[model samples]
Target chain A: MKLVAVTSCPTGIAHTYMAAEALSEAAKAAGHELEVETQGSAGLDRLDPATIAAADAVIFAADVEVRERDRFDGKPTVVAKVKDGINRPAELIERAVAAAAEAPAASTPAAAVPAAGVSPATKAEEGASWAGRLRGWLMTGVSYMIPFVAAGGILIALAFLIGGPEIASKVNGGTFDGHTYKGVSDLTLILNQFGVAGVMFKIGATSFSMLVPILAGFIAYAMADRPGLVPGVVAGLLASAVGAGFLGGLIGGLLAGAIVLQLVRLDVPRAIAGVMPVVIIPLVSTLVVGFVMLVVVGKPIASATNGMTGWLNGLGDSNKILLGLIVGAMMAFDLGGPVNKVAYTFGLASLSAGNLNIMAAVMAAGMTPPIALALATVVRPKLFNDAERKAGEAAWLLGASFITEGAIPFAAADPVRVIPSMMAGSAVTGALSMAFDATSRAPHGGIWVVGLIGHPLLYLVAILAGIGVSAASVVALKSRRILVPSGDAVAAAAPSSRGVVAA
Target chain B: MSQIITPDLVDLDLPGTDRVAATRALAERLVAAGRVTDLDGFLADVAAREAQMPTGLEGGIGIPHARSAHVSEPSLAFGRCAAGVDFGAEDGPAHLVFLIAAPDGEGAEHMKILASLARRLIHASFKDGLNQAADPAAAATFITQEIAA
Candidate 1:
């Protein structure tokens, strides 16, 4: 059978490709041709109508909903969890083949039946429940906001590197009447006069200024599509103007998305309805969001933001260590999954509030997992294959750059052993960093920002210690055990000896 | 769609030591019934899929299927192994096995039957009905009727 399949996951990273690969391999083994389109972090690999027309069946192996699934209505279909596709592709394919044979001819091909465990409504509702849907919107916003954050942060880091920490104040306080310097040294005077690094700093600051609005805009866009963008951005700007931070951006995004979605659903005459999405809806929604943010909610949100930051700033040493441990474990938990995102976002919010230590601990912990895995591969070569060893070599660079996603392959392959090992290391690092009172001024630069880090030697010690623990533990655990999918669940039920019945 | 399986395609009790032997045994039955034109070609396709991933699911079921040029029509072969065949599932070996085969160029029709069979297989009652079937005819009737419904 000629088959077409789509694979996606909430994070749109490793699992998406793994499921796609599994499906294709199964299809080939079955002597059937298959094409798999992956909707992943990188973007979409679209399946054309020609492929759909020729397909005997369609398989949607996704945790997230398969976009444009209606296109497959004329084909026999099987929808299963992405993990199930990885585990039971042959069965899924057989089911699809059977459905194809039973479905009537193309004259009335509309009766394509859903396989077991999937209904059309449920498929659409994959992440449609209130909280899940909200999470999806936030993730969309985060994904879109990442580039701006990276660019702005790296530029600011560079500015600090070249012009020193005093640059921000110096650029404002120091003065030069075109030729004469006042209140600064020669280099500082000249540098401050020309504002050479200052330009880069200002541009970066400008980009940082856009972060909240962009996050808000994209979150709303994810919820109501393009119609929500204008109001969301405007509301975010209002929040920023009123001294509201990430929390305000989040609320503004939600409010704008809701308002715009409601507006989109409003009944109107044909000509006016046609114009509404392009003009009327955006205009009305933006005004509404602006009023809500500036007039009603601004002061309350600003005070809440201040209170949150103040409380974080006032945390005692023990509380700080506990907070760091929790954040660190979350960062390593899924290796850039939603839990990791929550911790990282919290760190960013803290950075905006001038608490550099939280960001420092978060980044250090985030960087530990992949680095530890890479170290483990070197320390115990027998535990990993040739391919994995090669991957470890690349992981060194990814870890140094603080891309937590570098550990995903290892975690995906052996979550049972790798994740806990990673979490252990990260928690140690986070807690130790906090205990040592290490702080980092730069939002990100990985090891390159070691110069900007407070208690640099102890910070390095904390990181190395974490690497040692994670590397040793992961190697030990993996050697003693096999990586069963959802192995933890199996382990919890070991006494019962009823694996199949648990599900 | 036409009946994809018959008594000729059913084996109430198949004795095979492993997945390969079981798969080949089922494919041979299809060949013997004139449903398959090239036995080697068809078996090769089935073996290729088994090598890719073990078809053993969580249950005691192994579904090994192929779409091959050797197949004359879309067909299903059922085998109940009293002695289990190891299909390399995480849980264990498989006792109830299904071999789905389809001829080349009949993709749509093949998938329709395959999907219906898959949907019915999810129910424990449906599996129990197949397990308790008296003979090949009874098993075939049970499978065909259940899928049709």
Candidate 2:
């Protein structure tokens, strides 16, 4: 017997390929010639029209909607879940073969056979996988969030550039001449007002703020496959409502995903499959996740966030330097991963609450690593390879403009040494800025872009000092040769294409 | 079944021909080989079906086919080209061509054959082997062995 099959999963990942492999192996064992095509993240592969022409039967093992079904107008096709392809591939194949064999000889003309559109239930079931649904939601949400982060960060930068010291005194609770303070204070007020433009902005920002939860929700959806989306969204919303924030959202997503997987095993009718994703799973999972967030998870996280904020506000005098060091290290440690984002978020929240010094320390530490690393590669060329030297030139511009991603290539190439070195440099800069009572009215931008920094000259001095130390340390520590040789260098060093190298 | 398989039905440069041209060329070959009675009717059948939707299969392959009133019997033409031709695929370029010809009233056998071929072509090694076969005889031998297994 000969058979043809198509395999696909919602997330476009593991299960699709696994099912294809299982079916191929089973057919081979059964003395049947089998050909299986996988629809994955990278797209389709290995398609031959001749094989399709000769197959005795067709099988579709999928969680997502399969396109181009009209091509199989006359063939008997067995549509089953990818799981069936994995656990009972031979059985599925045999059934398809039997059906094809038993069908009456076509009395009707082939050209007259009607093309079949996919059933609505099948369409719904195809998209029911939690991952597919959540991803659709997250893609929508992330598209909305980018504007908030950019606008908020830039407006704050502009306020400082125009108003400067007088506004700083007002936010710090120092009494300036009311008239002078009012001039600066008015601009801050105007900027703050845009933070809530209208009901639409409010809703959009609220959705955007739930970004992490959305990511978690989609990941869970991917795992549980269909019937996971509803629960995942419910869990995400619950996490948001209860202040479990992103962590709660992650838990909710996972919980929803697991529950849906269990539900799918019940072998419900194909008609109900579509409804399970949009209505049933969400309703059940939301109730469970929401209850947990409200009763068990919400209070502790809210209290912890408050307690941390209070401690941060009270950090003064003798403890100021220590606080700065910690904040600085946290900001640079992950370079924009969760820990770094958390530190940056804290600084922005503090700015909203009128605490400018913490933001100052953050800005100082955030800009140090890239600037220092860029300087290091320039001052000591032998410490890096040719690629690093070229990358250093670009990093210099990004570093000077205060884009922390400037150091990413270096860190990615050698995280062990580069990351630790950056953390140390940033921490020292932050601690020193705090100790010197450095202040910034704005959130970010490099030292040379003084409009964004308070006490611009002092900030420049501190930045330069940090860069000097980091560059010297890198020169001392980094090896005198490139770690990974350049492609050109490797080619040049090769004996010859015609000659083989002895092991 | 007075079907005929001709040399033109098995070409070396088909992987590079335009899909419409290739299909016409295939139909012409079948007509010349006396596999089908009316060439114009066969071409019309294929064009009408193609107008509804393309038959470009996934995995860098395509099956451009038509069942026509002109066709006297069901027949297949296999073509291979050193340089793959563009068949307006969603992912771009198609290298393998299988032009299927059947009587307008033929049964499910045509669909079954197309499905079987589509499934086997998913194996990268098999497609590569077929593409590299030295001649039409070698290609036919390989296909026979694959189906018989």
Candidate 3:
């Protein structure tokens, strides 16, 4: 017998697809033709009306309520929890079929059965659950957001490269006058005039800036399934437009998803299902979530974000020493994970605001851990395992290029000691460079690439000092082990278990 | 006389073996129990199916089952081993065995049975119950209830 199945989960991450997979495999094994519609983070992946019509039975394995149940008024329908779909789908289907067959024919009146239309099935299939739909919408936003960071960074780099050094010159000891830099001033004019590119870049950046809201929306979609998508997207858009950025988006997405799901469970007529996705759901969700974000949540969140950004940007001059320590510690804390990204993003933003000093400090702190670790391993092989020693050799180049991720392997292996040591060394470097009034033009790379930096020689000196401190600390910790031959040490320190071992 | 059992029946003892060698050994045991007819044929059938795709299902379980003409009748020979068998899964290993034996002619009914078994396995508690089942009869009874429910 042909069967139609719908699978969804609360998180819409793993369980949704897992249930679908189980059902498909079981059906294949049982010699029955089956079609499964998955309501997941990506939205309604597979929804074929013909399959539903042809099926001898229908199974709904979901945590969230499904929309357009009226379509299956006369058909055999089995609604079970997602867990049941995973653990007992065959049993559930058989039971559903039996239940449908045994039910009185009078229970579903012929007049009550709505004509099978695309809207009801479409709404049922796509808007069946709010969480899954929300996830899909939010992911769509995130996928579009990444290009902004890349484009903005590259354009700003070009602007700085063409402009003369004086373009970076401070005005009245506070503001920066781009007019002073002749080459860059001309280039900036031309770039600013490329209205289309500027608009595209702005939109991308603005969209990218709304990452938090999008994430929230997707999370909700994953929970609520198809019906959740409409509310989730609406909530995310509202969050972005109202200045909530990340926090507001998350709240809005969740609110929208929950509201839509509640409405779907009300079991409105089949005729209304078609209009729900495009009109009724979006209108209600936006009106509710938009009002909440704008009047209630928007102001506080905007103030908080602005306050945070201001606090971060103000970490210069007076508190240069403390700021350096914090930046340095954060960079080495997760190597290149969220903490490091936050610090790096803050420093990069500073470049646009004409405060290159923080960037200089950040660049110095960023390279310290990997460079220091590499040098430490080279000077004293006893401090690291054979695998780490070999990794250190490659890390030297990464350090020189200011790729902080190079130290991840070493940190992952021994986070406790390595992370603290790297943070201490980095913090020291950041503090010293900031105190010396060092400035950088670029967001990344070592002192070697900081030729355009103010006081380039000082930057190099600070980097050297940080590297020395890191190496010394590591050596002090590792001096107990005897230094083995370089070749043997390299063989012993293979990075992965799959690495070929040499005699 | 050494009985030649097909690979179709041997592949059923998946959850009963942790390695290829163990799986082969379980296949031999099933042959001794008269649950499988031709050992080579059963193994060949399993190898062929595995080459196409793995039988690893969701919920940390795997079902390595096959059908062949060598089998005289439809049967289920289950084996529960101490260690989890590595069935070349993307995530890990196989922990449950439900070897289904059907004649090559048993077409759609075989698929229906597989589907029913798969649907029941989607439940976490059901899987746990299967793993904790005291013996083969208990496991079979649990499975039968799951299919019926």
Candidate 4:
């Protein structure tokens, strides 16, 4: 038998892992294959969906709520207390095996089944609004696309760093200030003639070219699983062909995924059903999506993209600073969560359309939180706990490197004081970066890519000002208290295990 | 890696009627070894955990533990009670007692060690070996080997 289990305890320390080990040992002794996921204070190692899909039975040995329990919806499952798993593993395994044998084999391959544990689109049952679901789907697409962004973005930055920012402008047939984004022209010629800097820029730009398709493909993948991929990518390429840009890709992806999801639900004859996912679904959905993209929504989206890009490019200095405040607030609002990703995607969209200032503002705002928090800890050491103080020491490097999540521990501990302080600081920095006429071709890489930034000195100055303002505000907020009890000061100064869970 | 437990922290013959006495005896070794900085504060933390629910388990074992600011590191001290201590397990009094101490806040190393030890305690062979060990050194070494495994 192939068995999978999730073990958790209230304290999330000892018993969670003890149950996992006991279950594993008993499963091995009983000649069964078992994989156990331990959810504890150390953090959970979640079982992959592929593993869950392939399992014969599921066991939940949790004294507390099991996270993502719906993933095991259709599997034969045995629920038991956390201690029962440790002391009676053999009995639990016996019961699990019995449960598996009593259940009928699923007719469909587990991976092909939808609407249960498969995708975020199925979360409508949980009472999520349409807007929330839409955001989840869009965030899914953007998240998968970020690696390509970081890789391609940094490589392009490196190209500029080596070849003096003008090196990449050759491939686009224009300079940064007033040129339209014509996609990269003369790719093979550029590669053959341009040497090392040319190779970096061309390779990086080629990766950038895939950004729209990947975004479209994954958004579809998030909605309708594997079957949604082909149609989604096809529509994305069509969007690209029509000059519809990233905005068109987003619309096309939603259309393709929704179309495929409904098409797969068609009840075909048993004889022909086997080919549905591979042949009929892909072929039919792709054809529909392609037709819609070529004829229906393509041109409107392209005009919207061009209009947004033209507006971004034509912004006056005051408007740019205003845009900076909104972007900065979003970056610090969640401190590297969904809202931050949205701001980042906005920058990538502008970058793809050839508006360079938004990305510079984005990077500056993103870099402010950790640096500011680190600075706060130093100015008033009594404001943070020892663990936070240690984290703050590491935050300087993390912030400078543009890893915004380095400040999560602090924000999680004291969100009310930390997040707004960070927002105020980041807003100032973002506005200053834009007002100083700073621009970046790079999507990310904070201080490391200074040489590639337009007016590097002013960019640095903006960052320093933001850090100073944020640190001072955080210290001030912490020192001046309202509803906070006198006990807050004790928690701040307390040494080890004050926050640690007792086992 | 710092040694979480040494032979000096083990007791071959521990005397106590209840879980509190047995736990304190083992904890005293931690204080003597400088693994714990404050005995009364650490004991109060352990008592709080005990009050949450009994730390007793089936198969004659009791683990009284807490994450205390008084603990210098994550440490474990062992005792073999001559007369079993009642640890609230339905099975009966516990003969093998372990006092687990973790430094306050999120320290990783000792918790991993202690959690791994908790897993190993389920095996009859491992538990029996500890019960049959000839000396304190043998008992501590047996635990270290089982943890390493």
Candidate 5:
């Protein structure tokens, strides 16, 4: 069905564009032809009168009065908040289609007003920005979750430093050293070595537990603001409760936030406006997201995590090198991105499973990108920009400290060149680390935790080898001056094309 | 010829978590920039606009805007808070805040700048550009470039 939408927010600013983008995208995705008119601060980009006449249904997704509502008086109509344009485009389209079906087209040819508006030249070019926007939205959540990952991972590593690897394995809760703990909880904790280390381990694990929920909560916050938080958080906890991991958290966060954004778009009566934010929005979003997550999304991701666990365990001794290579590639693929986190989390999972090689590879590869980029900049300073040179200086400390995100500036600047090189280097390090049977009990603290690593010297050697490879590759790429489109470099960290990345 | 957002108007380390204080801080920058004739009077106008409805947008942003006689020119002041300040957003606090002060009367420059800004805000890259600015100068430059001034 053909649909026409008018999107306007109270401020007639950002929300207007966001809603227009959402509705058009959703409509297109659902196989419906859609056009949107944005009455924003930029003035009206009116829908063509001919186009509106052809539209079978009209969606008035406006917070303020539609400038030309009288034009669509006779058409099948769906009145909604502008928020829904972005968050509930498909639903709105469905309603419009249904409304069109219900209202007989030939029954009443209402007196036609004169064709008043021209076709807009501002039909936003969506192109590659769609993927970039989704990435931005997801990263919004991940960015917030990182502090939890760092502090929690380090604390757990610290616990290992003090109490040894047994604490983590013990806390993982299963058959261990003949003592079997049935579950993982405060109540289930069996502290045979109830020392300072054990207490630290518990504290660290507790902090780590909040990552998914925080990730989910903030993602919602990004998508829909204050109303999105309540639902996003609840759904995140649910994701964990159902064993869906960060993937589930990502989906649930998106779902909860979108639902809340859509709900807020509802034009509630003045009498109920007070209760809308506090009671109605949260209640409705939570209920809808809860049902969707538990029933629809929860199962698939649960199986995925469970399957990944089994696959990692099944890798055993024979496929250790292969496992290392795979995880290493993942670590460098985005350098602390979703793929990297998946590998890191996988390694963390294996730690509790009493397998340490995965963790060893994870660390080696995670440290490779920054160190390699830093090395590249130093080896061939002319190849790098001034900013790259500066970042290189800081990369040394960040890489040594095991902060993978230090390479973000470099990777973001020249992703096509930087990422593959880093991945290749990390993969080599990972495979070599596994080949040498390197293992780590600690989750973080790069050079500082060398004492905690099994075969420390070999591990360092593996990191060095990866660093050399990456530096060589990046420097070589730079020297060739095979310049990527300047636009792509900025696309690494954000939407280089503004007013449209989100649009 | 004068830019709407200047280096001095960009505060990288805006302190505290109170929106009122944050607004006042940004307003003070405008006063210092000589864009506003009166501080209290301008803030009062901003507060009144905010009272009608908050200027906060999703994705960690708060835009407190107003048209006032106290504002001598159309000016924008950017402030970022590491420790976010509550802007009455449902999600929590706002980390990035843009204070837009427009001169009273019939000038459309402020509206045009605002519309350009509103359009730009929808893009994550623009926000990222603002976020990653090393200093106020870099931020001011970026805003000018993106707003195409």
Candidate 6:
């Protein structure tokens, strides 16, 4: 079978080529003809009309949205991330082939291919292991949750930076029922302030508050698709209201997803099943999840959350640093995988309780991997390829925004070296942030909200120091095994590609 | 470009311990095929490109390609390293090697051919066909047919 593929990434460098290369290799090895067009920084290497016409299927492996996607409208297409293409090219190819074979013959050509809006989840999950499916769902949640966190956190931090330390109380002086602005000793009351700072503060806070619910909603959407959204969001809001925090959001999302999944599988009448997703499933699941959260598990979860926050607040400086180290390691472990989510969730869980130090540490650690990788590439240019070096240039902005996903390509390429280096750096940053008592008013925003951080200079220093450690470690680790063969002048002149050279 | 690679350029068993040696050996074949004008200059360019990123890929295939002033035309030389050549890929060394050389300033054609070769290399069966081919002529025919697809 003939197959055509397009590979792209936001950076449009490493992963794009990597995925293209992987797909091409896999297709050839499988004895199927394949052609890959790379949409990269260097620009489009478009698929020839002949190849496209002859192709039985199309594969889209991209992080950023693909341009001209409509070209494949009538073709059997397998859509996935560039990472998936690189890691599981054979599998993606197989799915594309199968999808092409399964296209219904009775329907119109346009209708025979799945609708434009159809998600790739079902098709991609056809042969996926349970663990793989779960990972996919969680990753989808995290990917969706990032935009909200980054935007909200940055805006909130801007508010604090512009409006000063007493901004929250100044903006909402009379409306607070009982929430105290911790560390604000001045207590400046600017009732109904409509200044620029005041407006910024209010808007930022509003966005910041939606963080948990959005996370839950999207997580459920990932699990059971659209039907799980309403219930998951309602459960998340309840979790926030009852002080269950991120953990509650996770539980709520999972519960909503599971409920929706089961509800959709029920042996209902044809007419009922048609309306199930849009009407019955959503309404029933929302009501059920909300009822369970409020009546059954709400109080216990809230108290548990409160207890945890209380314990964290009571920790001594050394213990806080230790906790910071652990959290930092977790954040760098999988580069936005489940382990990183645990650290991020812990930070968000404590956020509502005014324990900003943990959040500060978590964000700092989260920012380390990308920043360190970028720095490593800069310090030792030959250690990485042209695409990687280009990607590193983009990592700076991504890291500053606290997008841990920026380090994914590097980690995906060489996890053993990259992950360990990142972890060490993140741990150092997390521990130092806690030890110094540097705090951020926002959960994310990285260096963009630097002005809002308590002891901003110290925080910056801690982050830089971590980057240094990680960069140095990565360079050292990489260069250690790189051996150039003697007697080959050309080999001696050229940079060694593999660190481990066979004798 | 379909005829750029030939049986004369296909070596069933090439000896090389690493990328530099392997690339040099393949570059030599392109010179013998009258595809390269200056063997040393072309080989140097290939080495420089390889240094930028090891062409060693998943499934043990190495595509060391470069556009150089030393090239007379676009060409492809195939090499099968029995002992494997280290191209620095995290996975492992490469057993199937393709040295692609194109005239300087003609990047489009070079990239097209490389892309084409990359797609074919992805299939296990295609790689197996090349690996199990009895002679250089058979391997060249297999590659030519695959690329034509």
Instruction: Give me the candidate number with maximum lDDT.
Output: 4
lDDT of 4 at B100: 80
For model 1, how does the per-residue alpha-carbon lDDT over B69-123 read when each residue is reduced to its tens digit?
A: 7988778999998788887767878878988786655345355565557546645
Better of 2 and 6 by lDDT: 6
Docking class for candidate 3: incorrect
lDDT of 3 by residue, B67-99 (tens): 666655445444455466666655666666545
A197-253 in candidate 2: lDDT tens per residue?
222233333434545455445535444533455567667666667655444565666
Give the per-residue lDDT of model 3 (tens digit) for A315-383: 555687788777777777766544576677777777767888888888888888878888888886766
Off by over 4 Å in 3: A1-216, A267-278, A305-316, A325-356, A362-437, A441-449, A455-503, B1-149
Per-prediction TM-score, please? 0.37, 0.40, 0.37, 0.50, 0.42, 0.41
- B-chain TM-score, candidate 2: 0.79
When sorted by DockQ, best at the front, the candidate numbers are 4, 5, 6, 3, 2, 1
All models, RMSD in angstroms: 18.8, 17.9, 19.3, 14.8, 22.2, 19.1
Candidate that beats the other on TM-score, 3 or 6, i.e. the better one: 6
For model 4 chain A, the run of ten residues with the poorest summed lDDT: A494-503
- Indicate the TM-score of model 5: 0.42
| Model 2 interface CAPRI class | incorrect
- Tell me the docking grade of candidate 6: incorrect
What digit string (tens of lDDT, one per residue) describes model 4 on residues A1-503? 89999999765556777789899999999999999998876666779877877788899999889997876776779999988898789999999999989877633332324423444321112134454445445555655565555555556667765765555556555434344334345666665666677788777777667767876887786567677789888887887677555656777898988998787667789989988877998999999999998888766645654654455445534488888877877688766544566667677777767778878888898888888988888888877655567667767765775656556546644557788888889899888988998988776657766766898899989889888888888888988853344333223231211111101
Better of 2 and 4 by DockQ: 4
Q: What is candidate 5's lDDT per residue for A1-503, written digit by digit as tens?
A: 88899988765645676677677777888999998888876667678876776678899888899996755645679999875665567799999999989876421111121233311111112343543445445555655565565566566666766765556556665443335554446633445445666777787678767877887887786566557778999888887777665656777898987788677667779899878877898899999998887888767755665676566557766788898998898788866545676788888777777888888899899998888988888888877655467667767766776767667656644566788999999999999999999998777667766876899999999999999999999998877653543322212433221222121
Compute the lDDT of residue A1 as modeled in candidate 6: 86
True lDDT of residue A398, candidate 5 = 64
DockQ of 5: 0.12
Q: Compute the lDDT of residue B95 as modeled in candidate 6.
A: 92
Worst 10 residues of 1 chain A by lDDT: A494-503
Model 4 regions lying over 4 Å from their true place:
A10-13, A41-58, A64-79, A94-223, A235-503
Q: Name model 1 segments beyond 4 Å from true.
A: A1-136, A169-195, A269-275, A305-431, A437-455, A463-503, B1-149
Q: State the local distance difference test value for candidate 4.
A: 0.74
Worst 10-residue stretch by lDDT in candidate 6 chain A?
A: A494-503
- Quick one: best DockQ, which candidate? 4
